[model samples]
Target: MTTVALVNTASIQERRDAGGMYHHRTNFDKYHPGYFGKVGMRHCHLKRNQSFCPTANLDKLWTLVSEQTRVNAAKDKTGAAPIIDVVLSGYYKVLGKGKLPEQPVTVKAKFFSRRAEEKIKGVGGAWVLVA
Candidate 1:
């Protein structure tokens, strides 16, 4: 079994600037505090903002997953909506706040996001931590 995670490029950068969180900020202007001597995070989204992440080529990572999983949602309906396994950098205060499903889903690959974990767990799905 395999899984897929989708993260917008801008979200990664947003997480780095918010002192490890992604909220209460607009842009990455000025040296963000608490980033001293530590390697700064990188942006995977093509655009510099989250609003444009959808247009970014997140396919780079998805393509690899498709090859390994043998489950291409693009071709098959059963495997189409691959459980949104991976977590993006930012959180959806409203969306993530919704109730989770109620079922056990054997996690195959890795995922990020505390909220996502909680959502998955609420639905009785397993949340396998990864780096």
Candidate 2:
């Protein structure tokens, strides 16, 4: 079965193919990925923001900052461990959804829930907002 069959190729009238904007009828492989500019609208629906990001809880944070099976902070020459540096880079939203570390653990993040901030301060921990 081929699209170039006689019935398809020998049409009597010279039918104009539907215009290119007729996306619903277009073949999937016919896309001009580079030919189009600004392919989508910002309106008509809410799309996720480029900065929409992951959330961090205090309990999880403690694990990242604490050493194995002990109440001490993980070693870092400049600060906390490298694994936890992403939160400090202002991409994570921290929440007080889990236990706090025994020792004060300084953290830097873009956003912190009210409870998280309070808990951090309450438990002798410090938090700073990243720019």
Q: Could you report the Cα RMSD, in angstroms, for every candidate shown?
A: 25.1, 10.1
Candidate 1 Cα misplacement greater than 4 A, ranges: 1-100
Q: Which regions of candidate 2 are displaced past 4 Å? A: 1-51, 65-91
lDDT (Cα atoms) of all candidates against the true structure = 0.42, 0.63
The residue-by-residue lDDT of candidate 2 on 11-126, one tens digit each, is: 54335443445553355236554444576656666676755878877777755543562323433334442234436544478888977755556678878899988998886667
TM-score for each of the candidates: 0.24, 0.50
Clashing pairs in 2: none
RMSD of 2: 10.1
